[model samples]
Target: MPHDWKEIQAGDEEVFKKVFDSYYQPLCLYANKILNDIDLAQDLVSECFINFWEKRTSIEIRTSFKNYLLLSVRNISLMHLRKSGEKLGNSQFVIQELEYVEDYVNELEEEKQIVRVHQAINKLPEQRRKILQLAVYNNLSYKEIATFLGISVNTVKTQMGRAYRFLKEELKDDQLTLFLLFGSNFE
Candidate 1:
């Protein structure tokens, strides 16, 4: 056993490798129970390990390694689910619903719908695109975006309104337009 948790705390790669190798699969399995998507579960587990290593110096472990790893996985998975607007439930049922949704999108019309939506967004002015990206991708509030860009809250709201109008006009298809509107709002 690597007795010097201090060395691990200092970001020794070997210790991290040992810990990662030991915990990765079990953590993924644990996270999958909450996230229901295998890829997302794996991603959450990886993020948890990276976070653990990053904050290792201040980490105090009173529990066994398995318990600590599981707790970390659970927390990360829950965060991901919350962000994605999913609620935790039976893992199998959640996974089935996810797969069905993915398959539904894989149908022919959905591909064109996605492309049209992206094209409409691409057609937006650079400033509007930046504002939308900040608000949607980074989950920033209107006030935060205004502060970051040195603009007023009203300006941010106006830009978002303009962006939505452009998207609504460009994406004539109802599905695509609905997606652009709903997907733009993180909360």
Candidate 2:
């Protein structure tokens, strides 16, 4: 009910506290769905609010304040996942637009597939695991990972290829297909 963002923009601490109290728990819960770690989710949501307060004067909210806060938390959660080397397979971290009731079921199924793929990635050899994590989780390009790890671009590419091949062999057919289809784009 506290929608007077004007006061918040004007450095009213009480109004900002009210807004935070209203949205913080719900935002944390929503972030937890994607992050799967309540502690990390709470931390990310806290960071989102901190950034929101810092940017209040310059930021414009075109939608409901709740929506803006939720979107902010979602983006921050995804950034945390990227930094932590976690990849949510298929859909590429997009918030899906559900067209039917069955889409919800499909979404759950996809989440399971993503978890399986992540497990398979964890089982990869150490070098390939690191390379694939950089590519998939960190969103690093081959050249960037090469530079970061002090390896050649060709080495990065070659390791990534072997990583995928190993993953294909390790996972079952359906899961491997899902990984192949939704996994990061390879060169």
Candidate 1, residues 46-108, lDDT tens digits: the string is 888888888888888886454566667766776777788876666666455434433443443
Task: Return the top candidate by TM-score.
Answer: 2
lDDT accuracy of residue 142 in candidate 2: 92
lDDT of 2 by residue, 27-90 (tens): 7777777778999889988999899999999998887666677678777877887888888644
TM-score for all predictions?
A: 0.44, 0.48
lDDT of 1: 0.71
Q: lDDT of all the models against the reference? A: 0.71, 0.74
Model 2 global lDDT (CA atoms, 0 to 1): 0.74
